[model samples]
Target: MQPVDLNPKRKKENPLVWIFEPLERDPEYSRERFFNFQAAYLDGLLYLAVASGEEPWNGLVVCTSHDRQAGLLEAFPVLAPHPVLGKWLYVSQRDPEFETVAHQMVKLARERDPRMGVVPGKRKRSPDVIEMKSSSRKKKSW
Candidate 1:
Protein backbone atom coordinates (compact mmCIF):
# COMPACT_ATOMS: atom_id res chain seq x y z
CA MET A 1 0.00 0.00 0.00
CA GLN A 2 1.29 3.49 -0.88
CA PRO A 3 1.40 6.03 1.93
CA VAL A 4 -0.27 9.34 1.14
CA ASP A 5 1.99 12.33 1.67
CA LEU A 6 0.63 13.89 4.86
CA ASN A 7 2.79 16.97 4.23
CA PRO A 8 0.48 19.90 3.59
CA LYS A 9 2.86 21.45 1.06
CA ARG A 10 2.58 18.39 -1.15
CA LYS A 11 -1.20 18.51 -1.23
CA LYS A 12 -2.73 18.60 -4.69
CA GLU A 13 -3.51 22.11 -5.87
CA ASN A 14 -6.89 23.09 -7.24
CA PRO A 15 -7.19 21.78 -10.81
CA LEU A 16 -8.25 25.12 -12.27
CA VAL A 17 -5.43 27.14 -10.77
CA TRP A 18 -3.73 27.52 -14.14
CA ILE A 19 -6.68 29.41 -15.61
CA PHE A 20 -5.89 32.35 -13.34
CA GLU A 21 -2.13 32.36 -14.01
CA PRO A 22 -2.13 35.71 -15.80
CA LEU A 23 -3.44 37.49 -12.75
CA GLU A 24 -1.20 35.51 -10.41
CA ARG A 25 1.82 37.38 -11.72
CA ASP A 26 0.60 40.61 -10.15
CA PRO A 27 1.60 41.50 -6.57
CA GLU A 28 -2.00 42.27 -5.64
CA TYR A 29 -3.36 38.94 -6.78
CA SER A 30 -4.81 36.59 -4.12
CA ARG A 31 -6.73 33.35 -3.99
CA GLU A 32 -9.05 31.74 -1.45
CA ARG A 33 -11.52 28.95 -1.05
CA PHE A 34 -15.09 30.27 -1.16
CA PHE A 35 -17.71 27.71 -0.22
CA ASN A 36 -17.10 24.83 -2.63
CA PHE A 37 -15.28 26.99 -5.16
CA GLN A 38 -11.83 28.45 -5.69
CA ALA A 39 -12.05 32.26 -5.81
CA ALA A 40 -9.43 34.50 -7.37
CA TYR A 41 -9.08 38.13 -6.44
CA LEU A 42 -7.03 41.05 -7.64
CA ASP A 43 -6.46 43.90 -5.19
CA GLY A 44 -9.14 42.38 -2.96
CA LEU A 45 -11.86 42.57 -5.63
CA LEU A 46 -13.13 39.10 -6.58
CA TYR A 47 -12.89 38.67 -10.35
CA LEU A 48 -13.60 35.04 -10.91
CA ALA A 49 -13.90 31.56 -9.33
CA VAL A 50 -13.36 27.98 -10.39
CA ALA A 51 -16.35 25.98 -9.17
CA SER A 52 -15.84 22.26 -9.71
CA GLY A 53 -18.94 20.89 -8.13
CA GLU A 54 -22.48 19.94 -9.08
CA GLU A 55 -24.12 21.26 -12.21
CA PRO A 56 -24.76 25.08 -12.17
CA TRP A 57 -21.69 25.49 -10.00
CA ASN A 58 -19.33 23.26 -12.01
CA GLY A 59 -17.56 25.96 -14.05
CA LEU A 60 -16.25 29.49 -13.86
CA VAL A 61 -18.04 32.34 -12.08
CA VAL A 62 -17.24 35.80 -13.46
CA CYS A 63 -17.86 38.24 -10.64
CA THR A 64 -18.84 41.48 -12.32
CA SER A 65 -21.50 44.07 -11.70
CA HIS A 66 -24.85 44.08 -13.52
CA ASP A 67 -23.92 47.00 -15.76
CA ARG A 68 -20.91 45.13 -17.11
CA GLN A 69 -22.73 41.84 -17.72
CA ALA A 70 -24.03 42.93 -21.12
CA GLY A 71 -20.59 43.76 -22.41
CA LEU A 72 -19.00 40.55 -21.12
CA LEU A 73 -21.83 38.52 -22.56
CA GLU A 74 -21.52 40.31 -25.88
CA ALA A 75 -17.80 39.68 -25.90
CA PHE A 76 -18.18 36.01 -24.95
CA PRO A 77 -21.52 34.58 -25.91
CA VAL A 78 -20.46 31.15 -24.62
CA LEU A 79 -20.99 32.51 -21.12
CA ALA A 80 -24.40 32.90 -19.53
CA PRO A 81 -26.09 34.08 -16.35
CA HIS A 82 -25.82 31.44 -13.60
CA PRO A 83 -29.03 29.47 -13.19
CA VAL A 84 -29.48 29.87 -9.43
CA LEU A 85 -27.52 33.08 -8.97
CA GLY A 86 -28.64 35.19 -11.86
CA LYS A 87 -26.64 38.17 -10.71
CA TRP A 88 -23.30 36.63 -11.77
CA LEU A 89 -22.36 35.21 -15.12
CA TYR A 90 -21.02 31.69 -15.67
CA VAL A 91 -19.10 29.74 -18.28
CA SER A 92 -19.75 26.03 -17.96
CA GLN A 93 -16.75 23.71 -18.03
CA ARG A 94 -18.78 21.52 -20.35
CA ASP A 95 -18.97 24.27 -22.94
CA PRO A 96 -16.64 23.82 -25.90
CA GLU A 97 -15.23 27.33 -25.59
CA PHE A 98 -14.56 27.15 -21.87
CA GLU A 99 -10.78 27.17 -22.16
CA THR A 100 -10.76 30.10 -24.63
CA VAL A 101 -13.10 32.19 -22.49
CA ALA A 102 -11.13 31.36 -19.34
CA HIS A 103 -7.90 32.55 -20.95
CA GLN A 104 -9.53 35.72 -22.24
CA MET A 105 -10.94 36.50 -18.81
CA VAL A 106 -7.55 36.06 -17.19
CA LYS A 107 -6.03 38.36 -19.82
CA LEU A 108 -8.60 41.06 -19.16
CA ALA A 109 -8.06 40.70 -15.43
CA ARG A 110 -4.29 40.92 -15.85
CA GLU A 111 -4.80 44.18 -17.75
CA ARG A 112 -6.87 45.44 -14.79
CA ASP A 113 -10.08 45.71 -16.78
CA PRO A 114 -12.58 47.85 -14.91
CA ARG A 115 -15.45 45.49 -15.65
CA MET A 116 -13.81 42.34 -14.32
CA GLY A 117 -14.31 42.42 -10.58
CA VAL A 118 -16.52 43.43 -7.65
CA VAL A 119 -16.02 44.44 -4.04
CA PRO A 120 -16.99 41.31 -2.17
CA GLY A 121 -19.90 41.63 0.24
CA LYS A 122 -19.28 40.92 3.91
CA ARG A 123 -20.65 37.61 5.17
CA LYS A 124 -23.38 38.21 7.71
CA ARG A 125 -23.93 35.78 10.60
CA SER A 126 -27.36 34.22 10.98
CA PRO A 127 -29.63 35.93 13.56
CA ASP A 128 -30.24 32.71 15.48
CA VAL A 129 -26.53 31.95 15.68
CA ILE A 130 -25.87 35.44 17.05
CA GLU A 131 -28.62 34.99 19.61
CA MET A 132 -27.16 31.64 20.68
CA LYS A 133 -23.73 33.19 21.08
CA SER A 134 -25.12 36.03 23.21
CA SER A 135 -27.13 33.62 25.35
CA SER A 136 -24.05 31.47 25.93
CA ARG A 137 -22.13 34.49 27.14
CA LYS A 138 -24.69 35.32 29.87
CA LYS A 139 -24.43 33.71 33.37
CA LYS A 140 -27.03 30.97 33.81
CA SER A 141 -29.47 31.36 36.72
CA TRP A 142 -30.68 28.20 38.47
Candidate 2:
Protein backbone atom coordinates (compact mmCIF):
# COMPACT_ATOMS: atom_id res chain seq x y z
CA MET A 1 0.00 0.00 0.00
CA GLN A 2 1.13 3.55 -0.71
CA PRO A 3 2.15 5.71 2.26
CA VAL A 4 -0.40 8.21 3.57
CA ASP A 5 0.00 11.67 2.08
CA LEU A 6 1.72 14.04 4.48
CA ASN A 7 1.07 17.09 2.33
CA PRO A 8 -2.25 18.04 0.77
CA LYS A 9 -0.59 20.24 -1.86
CA ARG A 10 1.73 17.49 -3.09
CA LYS A 11 0.12 15.41 -5.85
CA LYS A 12 0.06 11.61 -5.72
CA GLU A 13 1.45 11.46 -9.29
CA ASN A 14 4.55 13.51 -8.57
CA PRO A 15 7.67 11.36 -8.96
CA LEU A 16 10.05 13.72 -7.15
CA VAL A 17 8.40 13.12 -3.75
CA TRP A 18 10.59 10.09 -3.13
CA ILE A 19 13.67 12.30 -3.49
CA PHE A 20 12.65 15.08 -1.09
CA GLU A 21 10.81 13.10 1.61
CA PRO A 22 13.80 11.09 2.83
CA LEU A 23 16.16 14.06 2.87
CA GLU A 24 13.77 16.17 4.93
CA ARG A 25 14.11 13.75 7.86
CA ASP A 26 17.77 14.69 8.33
CA PRO A 27 18.06 17.75 10.59
CA GLU A 28 21.07 19.14 8.75
CA TYR A 29 19.55 18.57 5.33
CA SER A 30 17.84 21.43 3.46
CA ARG A 31 16.88 22.24 -0.13
CA GLU A 32 16.75 25.23 -2.45
CA ARG A 33 15.36 25.51 -5.96
CA PHE A 34 17.91 26.36 -8.62
CA PHE A 35 15.79 27.28 -11.60
CA ASN A 36 14.33 23.96 -12.84
CA PHE A 37 16.09 21.71 -10.32
CA GLN A 38 16.28 21.18 -6.55
CA ALA A 39 19.67 21.38 -4.87
CA ALA A 40 19.94 19.25 -1.73
CA TYR A 41 22.34 20.26 0.98
CA LEU A 42 23.76 18.51 4.02
CA ASP A 43 25.27 20.67 6.77
CA GLY A 44 25.15 23.56 4.27
CA LEU A 45 27.21 21.56 1.77
CA LEU A 46 25.51 20.75 -1.53
CA TYR A 47 25.62 16.95 -1.86
CA LEU A 48 22.82 15.88 -4.17
CA ALA A 49 20.72 17.47 -6.90
CA VAL A 50 17.51 16.15 -8.50
CA ALA A 51 16.50 17.53 -11.88
CA SER A 52 14.49 16.32 -14.86
CA GLY A 53 16.41 18.13 -17.52
CA GLU A 54 17.24 15.74 -20.37
CA GLU A 55 18.42 12.27 -21.24
CA PRO A 56 21.46 11.26 -19.11
CA TRP A 57 21.14 14.57 -17.22
CA ASN A 58 17.78 13.95 -15.61
CA GLY A 59 18.02 12.15 -12.25
CA LEU A 60 19.94 12.04 -8.97
CA VAL A 61 23.11 14.19 -9.00
CA VAL A 62 25.88 13.52 -6.51
CA CYS A 63 27.89 16.68 -5.86
CA THR A 64 31.37 15.78 -4.72
CA SER A 65 34.76 17.37 -4.65
CA HIS A 66 37.68 16.27 -6.82
CA ASP A 67 39.27 14.36 -3.98
CA ARG A 68 36.22 12.18 -3.30
CA GLN A 69 35.42 11.41 -6.96
CA ALA A 70 37.36 8.17 -7.11
CA GLY A 71 35.93 6.85 -3.86
CA LEU A 72 32.36 7.74 -4.79
CA LEU A 73 32.72 6.09 -8.22
CA GLU A 74 33.80 2.94 -6.43
CA ALA A 75 30.62 3.09 -4.33
CA PHE A 76 28.13 3.90 -7.12
CA PRO A 77 29.33 2.35 -10.34
CA VAL A 78 26.35 3.63 -12.31
CA LEU A 79 27.17 7.30 -11.74
CA ALA A 80 28.84 9.46 -14.38
CA PRO A 81 30.01 13.08 -14.60
CA HIS A 82 27.22 15.52 -15.32
CA PRO A 83 27.70 17.64 -18.45
CA VAL A 84 26.56 20.91 -16.92
CA LEU A 85 27.49 20.39 -13.26
CA GLY A 86 31.17 19.95 -14.10
CA LYS A 87 32.63 17.68 -11.40
CA TRP A 88 29.29 16.43 -10.06
CA LEU A 89 28.16 12.85 -10.68
CA TYR A 90 24.86 12.02 -12.36
CA VAL A 91 22.90 8.77 -11.90
CA SER A 92 20.27 8.40 -14.58
CA GLN A 93 16.86 6.86 -13.89
CA ARG A 94 17.42 4.50 -16.81
CA ASP A 95 19.70 2.43 -14.65
CA PRO A 96 18.05 -0.81 -13.54
CA GLU A 97 19.18 -0.24 -9.93
CA PHE A 98 18.48 3.49 -9.77
CA GLU A 99 16.25 3.33 -6.68
CA THR A 100 18.61 1.01 -4.86
CA VAL A 101 21.65 3.23 -5.45
CA ALA A 102 19.81 6.45 -4.71
CA HIS A 103 18.64 5.01 -1.37
CA GLN A 104 22.15 3.84 -0.63
CA MET A 105 23.52 7.34 -1.30
CA VAL A 106 20.94 8.83 1.05
CA LYS A 107 21.89 6.31 3.72
CA LEU A 108 25.55 7.22 3.27
CA ALA A 109 24.64 10.89 3.57
CA ARG A 110 22.76 10.24 6.83
CA GLU A 111 25.78 8.42 8.18
CA ARG A 112 27.89 11.52 7.35
CA ASP A 113 30.23 9.68 5.04
CA PRO A 114 33.35 11.68 4.14
CA ARG A 115 32.94 10.67 0.49
CA MET A 116 29.47 12.20 0.22
CA GLY A 117 30.46 15.84 -0.23
CA VAL A 118 32.91 18.68 0.14
CA VAL A 119 32.66 22.18 1.59
CA PRO A 120 31.99 24.53 -1.31
CA GLY A 121 34.16 27.57 -1.78
CA LYS A 122 32.75 30.96 -0.84
CA ARG A 123 31.55 33.14 -3.72
CA LYS A 124 33.72 36.17 -4.21
CA ARG A 125 31.88 39.45 -4.72
CA SER A 126 33.27 42.94 -4.60
CA PRO A 127 31.85 45.35 -1.97
CA ASP A 128 30.83 47.83 -4.70
CA VAL A 129 28.90 45.11 -6.58
CA ILE A 130 27.04 44.12 -3.39
CA GLU A 131 26.24 47.72 -2.59
CA MET A 132 25.02 48.41 -6.12
CA LYS A 133 22.63 45.44 -6.02
CA SER A 134 21.22 46.36 -2.57
CA SER A 135 20.97 50.09 -3.35
CA SER A 136 18.86 49.40 -6.45
CA ARG A 137 16.12 47.89 -4.26
CA LYS A 138 15.83 51.05 -2.08
CA LYS A 139 13.17 53.61 -3.01
CA LYS A 140 14.65 56.94 -4.09
CA SER A 141 13.86 59.94 -1.84
CA TRP A 142 11.71 62.34 -3.85
Candidate 3:
Protein backbone atom coordinates (compact mmCIF):
# COMPACT_ATOMS: atom_id res chain seq x y z
CA MET A 1 0.00 0.00 0.00
CA GLN A 2 1.21 3.50 -0.80
CA PRO A 3 1.73 6.10 1.91
CA VAL A 4 -1.23 8.43 2.22
CA ASP A 5 -0.18 11.94 1.32
CA LEU A 6 -1.91 13.99 4.03
CA ASN A 7 -0.33 17.32 3.23
CA PRO A 8 -3.26 19.74 2.98
CA LYS A 9 -1.30 21.83 0.53
CA ARG A 10 -1.64 19.12 -2.05
CA LYS A 11 -4.37 19.92 -4.57
CA LYS A 12 -5.75 16.36 -4.49
CA GLU A 13 -5.90 15.41 -0.81
CA ASN A 14 -8.53 12.93 0.38
CA PRO A 15 -9.86 12.62 3.93
CA LEU A 16 -9.67 8.82 4.02
CA VAL A 17 -6.08 8.99 2.81
CA TRP A 18 -4.77 9.33 6.36
CA ILE A 19 -6.24 5.95 7.31
CA PHE A 20 -4.08 4.22 4.74
CA GLU A 21 -0.81 5.28 6.35
CA PRO A 22 -1.78 3.94 9.76
CA LEU A 23 -3.21 0.76 8.32
CA GLU A 24 -0.02 0.28 6.36
CA ARG A 25 2.12 0.71 9.50
CA ASP A 26 0.38 -2.07 11.36
CA PRO A 27 2.76 -5.05 11.69
CA GLU A 28 -0.03 -7.55 11.08
CA TYR A 29 -1.21 -5.80 7.96
CA SER A 30 -0.64 -7.81 4.79
CA ARG A 31 -1.07 -6.96 1.10
CA GLU A 32 -3.29 -10.00 0.60
CA ARG A 33 -5.56 -8.98 3.45
CA PHE A 34 -5.72 -5.41 2.26
CA PHE A 35 -6.50 -6.41 -1.30
CA ASN A 36 -9.05 -8.95 -0.15
CA PHE A 37 -10.88 -6.36 1.95
CA GLN A 38 -10.65 -3.81 -0.83
CA ALA A 39 -11.94 -6.24 -3.45
CA ALA A 40 -14.85 -7.33 -1.27
CA TYR A 41 -15.82 -3.75 -0.49
CA LEU A 42 -15.48 -2.66 -4.07
CA ASP A 43 -17.35 -5.69 -5.34
CA GLY A 44 -20.25 -5.06 -2.97
CA LEU A 45 -20.34 -1.41 -3.98
CA LEU A 46 -20.23 -2.35 -7.62
CA TYR A 47 -23.04 -4.84 -7.13
CA LEU A 48 -25.13 -2.15 -5.49
CA ALA A 49 -24.35 0.26 -8.30
CA VAL A 50 -25.40 -2.28 -10.91
CA ALA A 51 -28.58 -3.17 -9.07
CA SER A 52 -29.60 0.43 -8.45
CA GLY A 53 -27.88 1.96 -11.44
CA GLU A 54 -26.13 4.45 -9.16
CA GLU A 55 -22.60 5.39 -8.11
CA PRO A 56 -21.34 3.35 -5.14
CA TRP A 57 -19.17 6.02 -3.52
CA ASN A 58 -22.03 8.46 -3.10
CA GLY A 59 -23.37 6.22 -0.31
CA LEU A 60 -20.40 6.89 2.00
CA VAL A 61 -21.03 8.79 5.22
CA VAL A 62 -18.10 10.67 6.74
CA CYS A 63 -19.38 10.53 10.34
CA THR A 64 -20.68 13.90 11.48
CA SER A 65 -18.73 15.84 14.15
CA HIS A 66 -16.85 19.06 13.78
CA ASP A 67 -13.38 17.64 14.33
CA ARG A 68 -13.96 14.21 12.83
CA GLN A 69 -15.82 15.47 9.79
CA ALA A 70 -13.28 18.17 9.13
CA GLY A 71 -10.38 15.82 9.55
CA LEU A 72 -11.82 13.22 7.22
CA LEU A 73 -13.10 15.72 4.68
CA GLU A 74 -9.80 17.53 4.64
CA ALA A 75 -7.92 14.31 4.22
CA PHE A 76 -10.33 12.71 1.79
CA PRO A 77 -12.11 14.92 -0.66
CA VAL A 78 -15.15 13.34 -2.28
CA LEU A 79 -14.03 14.44 -5.71
CA ALA A 80 -10.53 13.03 -5.41
CA PRO A 81 -9.81 9.58 -6.82
CA HIS A 82 -9.36 6.79 -4.30
CA PRO A 83 -5.82 5.42 -4.15
CA VAL A 84 -6.89 1.79 -4.45
CA LEU A 85 -10.21 2.03 -6.28
CA GLY A 86 -9.06 4.80 -8.59
CA LYS A 87 -12.48 6.40 -8.30
CA TRP A 88 -13.92 9.46 -6.57
CA LEU A 89 -14.53 9.13 -2.83
CA TYR A 90 -17.92 10.40 -1.72
CA VAL A 91 -18.21 12.12 1.68
CA SER A 92 -21.54 12.54 3.46
CA GLN A 93 -20.69 13.08 7.14
CA ARG A 94 -23.76 11.09 8.27
CA ASP A 95 -26.12 13.43 6.49
CA PRO A 96 -29.34 12.11 4.94
CA GLU A 97 -28.18 13.44 1.60
CA PHE A 98 -25.71 10.56 1.33
CA GLU A 99 -28.26 8.14 -0.10
CA THR A 100 -29.38 10.56 -2.74
CA VAL A 101 -25.88 11.45 -3.75
CA ALA A 102 -24.72 7.86 -3.71
CA HIS A 103 -27.65 6.76 -5.84
CA GLN A 104 -26.91 9.47 -8.34
CA MET A 105 -23.25 8.56 -8.40
CA VAL A 106 -24.08 4.93 -9.12
CA LYS A 107 -26.23 5.99 -12.00
CA LEU A 108 -23.48 8.20 -13.32
CA ALA A 109 -20.90 5.44 -13.01
CA ARG A 110 -23.09 2.96 -14.89
CA GLU A 111 -23.58 5.51 -17.64
CA ARG A 112 -19.88 6.31 -17.85
CA ASP A 113 -18.49 2.80 -17.39
CA PRO A 114 -20.26 0.03 -19.26
CA ARG A 115 -18.37 -2.69 -17.44
CA MET A 116 -19.54 -1.41 -14.06
CA GLY A 117 -23.20 -2.20 -14.66
CA VAL A 118 -23.12 -5.57 -16.34
CA VAL A 119 -24.49 -8.25 -14.00
CA PRO A 120 -23.77 -11.90 -14.80
CA GLY A 121 -26.62 -14.27 -15.57
CA LYS A 122 -27.55 -17.07 -13.23
CA ARG A 123 -26.47 -20.67 -13.92
CA LYS A 124 -28.95 -23.27 -15.22
CA ARG A 125 -30.30 -26.08 -13.01
CA SER A 126 -30.67 -29.79 -13.80
CA PRO A 127 -34.08 -31.39 -14.30
CA ASP A 128 -35.67 -33.23 -11.39
CA VAL A 129 -35.91 -37.07 -11.59
CA ILE A 130 -37.96 -39.72 -9.81
CA GLU A 131 -38.06 -43.55 -9.81
CA MET A 132 -41.15 -45.76 -9.50
CA LYS A 133 -41.28 -48.86 -7.31
CA SER A 134 -43.14 -52.03 -8.19
CA SER A 135 -46.57 -51.77 -6.46
CA SER A 136 -47.08 -55.57 -6.39
CA ARG A 137 -44.67 -58.47 -6.29
CA LYS A 138 -43.92 -59.76 -9.73
CA LYS A 139 -46.41 -62.55 -10.68
CA LYS A 140 -45.08 -66.04 -9.98
CA SER A 141 -43.74 -67.53 -13.16
CA TRP A 142 -46.51 -69.56 -14.81
Q: Which candidate ranks first by TM-score, i.e. highest?
A: 1
Task: Give the alpha carbon lDDT tens digit for every residue of 1-142 in model 3.
Answer: 9999888776442333323232344343322222112211122232221111134332242112232234434533453333334332433334455445455434443333322322223445444321222424456667
> What are the per-residue Cα lDDT tens digits for candidate 1 across 32-97?
887777899998999899977778988899988788899888988898988987878898899989
Residues 31-111, model 2: lDDT tens digits: 876445677788988777677657755688887876778888886788877777768888887778888888888877777
Candidate 2 local Cα displacement, residue 119, angstroms: 3.2
> Which order, best to worst by TM-score?
1, 2, 3
Which one wins by lDDT: 1 or 2?
1
TM-score of each model, in listed order: 0.84, 0.71, 0.23
- Candidate 2 overall lDDT versus native: 0.76
lDDT of 3 at 62: 19
The number of clashing residue pairs in each candidate reads 0, 0, 12
TM-score of 1: 0.84
TM-score of candidate 2 to 2 decimals? 0.71
**RMSD values, in order shown:** 3.5, 6.1, 19.4
Give the 10-residue window scoring lowest on summed lDDT in candidate 3.
Answer: 32-41
Kindly report the root-mean-square deviation of model 1 from the true structure over all alpha carbons: 3.5
Q: What is the lDDT of residue 128 in candidate 1?
A: 100
- Model 3 spans > 4 angstroms off: 1-87, 113-142
